[model samples]
Target: MRILLIEDDPRLNEALCCALRQEGYEVDACLNGQEGLYYMETGTADLVLLDRMLPGLSGEELLQTRRKAGDTTPVLMLTAMGTLADRVTGLDLGADDYLVKPFAMEELMARIRSLSRRGGGFHVDSGELAWGDLTLAELSCQLRGPGGECTLSRRECGLLCALLRHPRQTLGRSQLLLSVWGPDTEVEDGNLDNYIFFLRKRLKSLNSRAAIQTVRGVGYRLTMQSEDSL
Candidate 1:
């Protein structure tokens, strides 16, 4: 399926693009709402992962604009937590789903899967990921951890998906950046740091005993922790 990722954070954009590509899915991405809308206008994306607080043309406005123009493509809105009210407003504006920031990749994948199942897009996922109580249905893009549920932004989903595939191997910052973001992109290393912070927060919230360990001065690890009850 062709996926459009609309996120401003360079680290997030790069990681998501790279990870999705590795999964063999056709993906096109944008840094802001304007670029995202332009792509949507082209009718090239099967689904869109749109950030709510964008620079120009916020995600909410973008979705409403598309719908006003009679475009009904599936859209998943991304916002930081504490913005559930914002999500409801966005949904009223025409978004199909909403995901908060500090979310797991698996959760993001699950939401996409849910969208795909409804939209009937051609999916190309491997479905081989599991971390602690979390499970990733790669081909389906769904995540589950105990009873708590969360959907991932495309960027967050790809970051975690890549880490899950790598397990305890210490992926270097450069390697991770290249792997997640295509090598041709002009993103900087600082971007990777931001995503690591985002992923860590998400995992901690889902399960405090979960493992997405950072190797000082290096990259990270997404290993299974046995002590947790969940």
Candidate 2:
């Protein structure tokens, strides 16, 4: 899961980022509302943890602007103003959920999971994804075949998940870099290609015939063109 956390407080931001990563979610954070809006305009985030009070543009305004622009990425408003009217206004502004500040990490995770899964809490695993003999367990994040289970590192899992999500679509190198390593990481350039190589080797071990096709002067694609769209 990729999440954008728009919080200006350094302490809260640090806590949220650390905790969410521990739970295996990729997070990009911004210290101000303008930065948050900038990230939203530039990156693909599965959800947004927006603080209601922010400089430059308030969270309410940000949500309104995103809705006005037809961006439906889920937004969960996190604020200190815990009141019925506050919650009501947040929902009116198109927030998917509202969490008061000084909230429990477990509650935040639960809410985040609920928002990502649309309230039922199921992780929404799709039907089996196959690239030749290589198969991905969408729900389990496993790479396996008739032989047995093949282990995948954290980065490898992230890469394969992304490729499977957008099968046959050429994901740009920068996009992959940003997704695998969060915006704040100091990863050297070309790290994405290295991870791709690792992912390809793991796939091969599972007899995957799907190629991570590289486009000269561009990026890579998981070429499973023969398969139907999910």
Candidate 3:
């Protein structure tokens, strides 16, 4: 699963990132809320660990913005304020769960598993992502189709998930880059093109009707191949 950690405490952020990575999850960590907001808005992360107190934009504001904009990615609020009103407020602002600071790592992991199974605001059932005849199993890092199934690299899985999340819509190049490679990473445009090429090949090999169509100067869209064609 892909997770975004938004926390200002440098030590905590590093520790959380390391722990999540060790647990076999792809993680992106940021020290400020602005960067966190940008990542969340990209609609890539399966889950978000948001610190209630942050630099630039507070976690509350970030959650509020995402909720207002119809972004349903699950958010778990982390803060030192362990009070009744605080927890209620966080949930009211669209937080799926709240963890008080100095929390047990075991509990955090448990919550993550629970939220992942429940899915984000998009209401993904279990941990499977599906489009057309293909299913991307999030935990196994495998793509399954009518022709067969194959394991996917981490980057390939990320790119595929981003596209599957928006099926028919045309995703712009920059948006795909930000969602898959992240905003801070410097990657060539050709890199994305290469992945798209490989993904198309995979679909063809599976004999699936789904195809990734290039939108000329725009980007790409996932659509079903017409049975009459070829």
Candidate 4:
């Protein structure tokens, strides 16, 4: 699973990132609410770990903005404010769960699992995400089609998931980069191009009807059109 972590304290942020990574999750760590919001708006993270007190934009303001924009990615608010009213306010503002500071990692993991099972994030019940005849198994990163099935690397899986979520709609390069590689990563345009090439090869190998079409200077889209049309 991919998680966006927003914590201002340098030590806590680093520790959380390490722990989350050790748990086998892809994590994007941000020091402030503004950066966190930038990542959240990419519609990529499966979960968000938001700190209530942030440097630039407060966590409450960020959460409110996200909810107002209709982003349903599950948020677990982490804060030092342990009062009942604080918890109530966080929940009322759209947090799916609340964790007071100095909490155990075990409890945090438990809450994450619960939120994932509750299906508020990027999770799907069938363990598969489908577009046209293509179906990708989340756990194994396996892409199956009429011809056969092939396992994809983590990055490939992330890229394809973003496309499948909005099939046929153009996804900008920057959006794809942020979503797949984690926000604010310094990935090159050629890197994305290479991945696109790899994905096309996988589709061709499967003899799938779907294709990833490039939009010249714009970006790319998933389509069920013949290659000749491109």
Candidate 5:
């Protein structure tokens, strides 16, 4: 999943970004609240790690603005304020969860997993996503169909999951890139093509009727073959 981290301390911000990246998550980090607000407005991040204290705009203000605007993206407030009133205020301001400063990375990761599974736009109970006859085990990166099943690499699973989530709608290349690789990642355009090719092969191996159709000079969309084509 992609995460947006808004923290003012350069050291803490850098450390958190590195740790999140090492854990295989796409992370976009900013040192202040204004920039953080811009990143959140882009709607690229699946989860947010927001610091309560920030310059220009406070985390509480940012969260309040996002929530007021009806953005339901899950946010985990990271702050040094550990008092009960502080925790209640943050939660009341619309944070999905709160984490105080000097936290263990293990605990942070656990919270991220919980929030991602809870609000990452997938089927929470089943841990699976489906479109047409194709079913994807999100946790295992396994793709299953009427014909067969195959394990997908994490990247491939992410690419396919994005498509399955919005079947039949053309998604721009840039959008797909931001979805799979964070906005900060320096990935080549060809890398996306390679993953698309890999996903196509995975679908074919399962003999599924689904297809990832390219939209000439635009992007790609997922479609299912008609019975006559089968």
Candidate 6:
């Protein structure tokens, strides 16, 4: 899972980032709320750990702005204010959970796991993306199929997510490229083809009937093939 850690204290930020990384999570650490806001705007992070007191923008202001802009990524507010009123205010401003400072790392990790399972605000109802018998766990980057389960690389996960979001539809090359790679990325067409090849191989290994079929001049479509066809 990708996490954004926004904390002003240098020691605390470094410690938290190191701990989270050790636990196998990709973390982006920032010292203030402005940087945190910028990262949040990218819509890349799965969860955010925001400190209440900040330099550029306060944590409350940052959360309010994100909520107003319709960014629904799960947020866990971290602060020294442990009073009832403070917790109420944070929750009212759209924070999914709140944690006070001087907390145990174990408890923090537990909360993160719980929040990830609950998914982000956009996917609170269904955390796992599914099609047919194939299931993709976004937070863990694990794909489960008829054969078994396997972990997917970052690019592979992104590609599968894009295709799964519009299953059975032919997503054009440009659209897939922009979604998998970034809009500003200058990548060769062959790179996308390579990933497609990898995904097909992965599906076969998983014994999945789902196939990634390429259109003559268009992009690709994900569909379930009949037993006779396979």
Best of the candidates, TM-score: 5
Q: Model 6, stretches more than 4 Å misplaced?
A: 121-230
- lDDT (Cα, tens digit) per residue for candidate 3, span 1-230: 78999999997787777656644588989999999988887878989999999988999999999999988888899999999999999999999999987764545765787787784543334567888899998666689999999988766776677678778889888767655554335788899899999998898888889889999999998888788973
lDDT of each: 0.74, 0.75, 0.82, 0.84, 0.84, 0.83
Question: Which is the winner by lDDT between candidate 3 and candidate 5?
Answer: 5
- Per-prediction TM-score to the true structure, in the order listed: 0.56, 0.53, 0.54, 0.54, 0.57, 0.53
Question: Taking the tens digit of each residue's C-alpha lDDT, what string does model 2 give over 1-230?
Answer: 78899998897788678767755688999999888998899757888999999988999999999889888888999999999999999999999899887665545765775676673222443434666557776445578864567767667766776676677788777666555564445677677778888887776565555668897777888874244431
What lDDT would candidate 3 get against the real structure? 0.82
Screening candidate 1 with a backbone cut-off below 3 angstroms (N, C-alpha, C), the clashing residue pairs are 18-180, 105-157, 107-152, 108-152, 109-141, 110-141, 110-142, 127-138
Q: What is candidate 6's lDDT per residue for 78-123, written digit by digit as tens?
A: 9999999999999999999999876755457657878877755423
Per residue, candidate 4 scores C-alpha lDDT tens digits across 1-230 of: 89999999997787678656744589999999999999999988999999999987999999999999999999999999999999999999999999998775545755776788888636535657887889998667899998899999877877887788778889888667655664324677899899999999999899899999999888999999665753
The 10-residue segment with the lowest total lDDT in model 6:
119-128
User: Per-residue lDDT for 1-230 in model 5, tens only?
Assistant: 78899999997787677667755578999999999999999999888999999998999999999999998999999989999999999999999999886675545765777887775583245667888889998778889998889999877877887788788989889777666664345789999999999998888888889999999899999999998987
What's the lDDT for residue 139 in model 5? 72
The per-prediction tally of clashing pairs is: 8, 0, 1, 0, 0, 0
Q: What is the alpha-carbon RMSD of candidate 3 to the true structure?
A: 11.6
**Candidates' RMSD to native:** 9.7, 10.6, 11.6, 11.3, 9.8, 12.2
| Cα deviation of 191, candidate 4, in Å | 46
lDDT of 3 at 62: 91
User: What C-alpha lDDT does candidate 6 achieve relative to the native structure?
Assistant: 0.83
